[model samples]
Target: MSTSTLDLAASLRAWGVIRTPLVRLREIEPSGVAIYAKCEWQQPTGSVKDRVAAAMVARAVADGALPPGARLVEASSGNTGIALARLAVMTGHPFTVVVPENVTAERIQLLTAFGAEVVFSPAEEGSNGAVRLAERLAADEGWVLLHQYENPANVDAHAVTTGPEIVEELERVDAFVACLGTGGTLMGVGRALRDVWPEVRVVAAEPPVGETIAGLRTLADGYVPPIFDPTALDGRLLVRLGDALAMLRRLVRTEGLPVGPSSGAAVHAALRVAERLPAGSVVVTVLPDGLERYLSTRVLELDAEEAGGLTLW
Candidate 1:
């Protein structure tokens, strides 16, 4: 008889799946703020969602939601698809990811390489289009949808892994900054940190109201992830795609951190928070992913009003 298969989380950590550490930086001071970045983009799948995806698929297997040979389906910007696909390959499940056509080719190539079938939505409509299409597919096909938008596993991943790591590394974090996607990372991490220090502020960095950031959709675009509890945040701010991209450059040049646009937004927001706080207030930011995944867009360089009208944003 064959031995029982290994549990996904245990196997990963046992195999030395790297843990992202909190790296503290010299005081970019605003009186109460000391900036730190939890470089989660450095995770195995190149994004913080890797934790969410792993938790998601593993829970599905245990709960019988995703049976052996069950087909998993969902929507993504880029990083989520990549994360889910990598984990699906690990758990021996078949998955189909729906994404906007405008996402980075690196994301598509990585998803395909990891054995996920990708369906592209209309480019101009962005992630909103992908969301509608994915919901339609799930309804018609009755596929097991690991809806990251509302997935509790997404929040739990941050609560368990990301938040604790930050707390362990810092004596006191006065403010936490996160890129607002489906609001999972921010809400989850914010909740965990607040439990220890209720006064610690949580800030969200969102794409400029009408614009898209990475492959994420927004509340105004007509959907909110069920996992998102808006009251979780202390404040929310918008970041322009260009400003975010520029901050990525500064991060690499000034700090040697090559993170993605969402991460850049966090940094930009963190700096803003830093400017308003008292000296020595610990400010921690979660950078969800890296820039290499968006190389096709030249997120580092730009010309005219549009980058390339594709990956540029």
Candidate 2:
């Protein structure tokens, strides 16, 4: 369906967007230290990528790079594709998402439910495989690719919106922790925080090299997102899968926060940062998404022997 520029604006207005909340974790923080979590799951698609998707599509349309009703293609493990799929439907454009076969079953179902075409790349190659496949498809078929890994719009979205929200809510941020995925959140929010308070430390919670954690990536994994700058980070901590999963359970049981694995990793890193800081320090982190999409992954489940659950807490 060919859509005119006039109709594009109308289509865009039909969807409701939101400014997600920033909640301070006073109850869960150590004495004299404060930690906050920006709740991105409150977005339209229940993920932070909602901001990225909206920004990318709107900018494409405004810049005339994306003609009305042009098909958009992307590679994602889940959240970005889900956000793009919802936006594609809203903006009267069809979208195609290429994902690795190992992505959670819920994500595939969510993409299908959004009426977007889903293609599976090899699981062994992970997101890079999906990227390779998407690049080929976009080149061969003339589909416009919204390459989130390299898109300036992804960074701009967080800088213009998310960054200000944090600075507005908190008096001062001593450290900002975020997982390293496409690096948009880390780079954009880090820059904004540093611009406001030059001493704000930007820390990264990365999965161990050669280890797998959904929605987070290690730099040594062969594909570094173009937007990522190692120099911007004041510190980098390696989160093991076991530790991340353990934190996920702890957060759920103790704080009543059922966030995904990457969020857990960020929280773990944030806590460590808080421990070393002097009293009255503030640290902010991001909770990217909720547990709904990740239930199918065993990270949230117990083994048959421990099916009754960990009772010793």
Candidate 3:
């Protein structure tokens, strides 16, 4: 390897933009329960998916699967697409993102703004439809598909970096909670924590079926991700849309964290698990992204009737 390339690879590990802060949320729950959140939204691409995107691209290049200036394709709700779009540009690869038609205008605009080719799948089918369409495109044109839903690197990124970061900071984790999308974070982080603490409870926080909560998916949905395994989780918590919205508001006001709906849902489930645990138990949750990606949606603009029924669960 060239001297310059070796230096670049070595310095990449110490890059300041790659690390994010972990916040210990004391006021969000009872005195006995301690809730720690990994604020992944502070990443360079503004989401936890940045880690996955970087890993996938690096592996593809190293394995000679992706040539210089190759074109790439992927299916994402918002965060992953945006992360890949940014990375593709930086790495001199053209990217095409197939997303749900119902996604907020803010996300669509951001993807296009990053110079990514954007395609809209059917709104009724949600993210699953985007996956189908992207798969077809990948097969037809021989495009390099990052396939986050099935990629092992997606899980590995969290297992190596995100999970160890939490274990290092908190020392011990009684319970680990994360929203279920493609199951990368839950599976990767869960396995990492279990390696250290065999009794650590791995919980999944998912939105109720038939709800339009972005960034989350229920297992009841017809298409289960290839990487998802029910046996990996200790339990699953169903979060309602109204309750998630309420928690979003509370988090912004009380904790000063303007997190996304999926994050709010994860926090809600974490608090539920915390309530059942003994005093001084530690619970860690992953906030996948912040509110910047959901500004054009109803995430922060709930009406009176909608807000009234949602009690903090």
Positional deviation of residue 55's Cα in model 3 after best superposition, in angstroms = 1.1
- Runs of candidate 3 with Cα error greater than 4 angstroms are 1-17, 212-221, 303-313
Give the distance in Å from residue 217's predicted Cα in candidate 1 to where it truly belongs. 15
Off by over 4 Å in 2: 1-15, 212-221, 302-313
For model 2, state the Cα shift of residue 292 in Å.
0.8
Candidate 3 lDDT score at position 77: 82
Which pairs clash (backbone N, Cα, C closer than 3 Å) in model 1?
31-278, 31-279, 32-277, 32-278, 32-279, 32-281, 77-215
What would the per-residue lDDT of candidate 3 be over residues 139-195, giving only the tens digit for each residue? Answer: 998899989999877887788788888888877899999988889999999988999
lDDT of 1 by residue, 158-195 (tens): 77677877877778989998887788888778888998
Worst 10 residues of 2 by lDDT: 304-313
220 in model 2: Cα distance from truth in Å?
A: 8.1
Candidate 3, residue 126: lDDT: 74
Task: For residues 14-127, write the lDDT of model 2, one tens digit per residue.
Answer: 455466778777656789999999887777888888888887787787777789878899999899999999999888999999998877788889999999999998776677
Give TM-scores for every candidate, taking all chains together and pairing residue i with residue i: 0.89, 0.88, 0.89
Which stretch of 10 consecutive residues in model 3 shows the poorest summed lDDT? 3-12
